[model samples]
Target: MEYTFDQAAALLNMGRNTLIRRLREEGMLGTDNLPTSRWRGRGVFRVITKMYRHPVAGYIHYGRTVITVKGLNAVSRKLRLAQHQPEGSRNRASWVN
Candidate 1:
C-alpha cells in the first residue's frame, strides 16, 4: 500500500518537511533526479498528483502526494544502514554483510 506524505512522516518519526527533503535527496521524489527510463517499472516511487478547483471559488488546491510501500522500505533500509555506519568511513562495501 502507498502512504501519504503525512503518514510516511509519522511512520518515520520526522517532520513532514524533513521527510520530504530526505525523499527528494534519495531520488524518491521529483522528475529531475529520475533516470533516463523515467522510473517506469523501476521499483521507485512515482508521484501521484491531483489538481482540484473549488466549485464556487477561483482557488486551486493540490492534493496530497504519496509514495509506495517499496519506497518506504527503501527509505527505512537506508536510514538503518546510515545509522549503523561509522563516521568518515568510506568503505561502504563492508557494510553489505
Candidate 2:
C-alpha cells in the first residue's frame, strides 16, 4: 500500500508541493534534490516509514495519516466485552447497554 508523492497529495486533498514540504520538514524525505523555494521546480521526494509512540498508543503512517493499531485493539476489546455482558448486568451501564 505504498504511495508516491502525487498519490499521497491527491488522497490528502493537498497540493503536491505542500505535501512534499511537510514530508521534508518531518525528515521523511531526502533534502538533497529539493528546490530552494516553493515557487521552484517540483522537488524529488519519497515516503519514509516511521513508527511513533504516544502516551497511550502506538501509531504508524501509511502515507496519509497515522493509524493507531494499539488504540483500535483496546477499543475492540472493550466493545467485545460489552457485547458479551448479560442484560441488566452491573458491567453493562446505560451508555454501553
Give per-model CA RMSD.
9.0, 18.3
Q: lDDT tens digits, residues 33-75, model 2? A: 2323542332222224556766676574443332122222222
Model 1 Cα lDDT, one tens digit per residue, 1-97: 6677787677777877887776567655563433224444655455455566788876774534565666566667755533223234557544333
TM-score of each: 0.52, 0.32
Which regions of candidate 1 fall more than 4 Å away from where they truly are?
A: 31-40, 53-64, 81-97
Residue 69, candidate 2: how far off, in angstroms? 13
RMSD of 1: 9.0
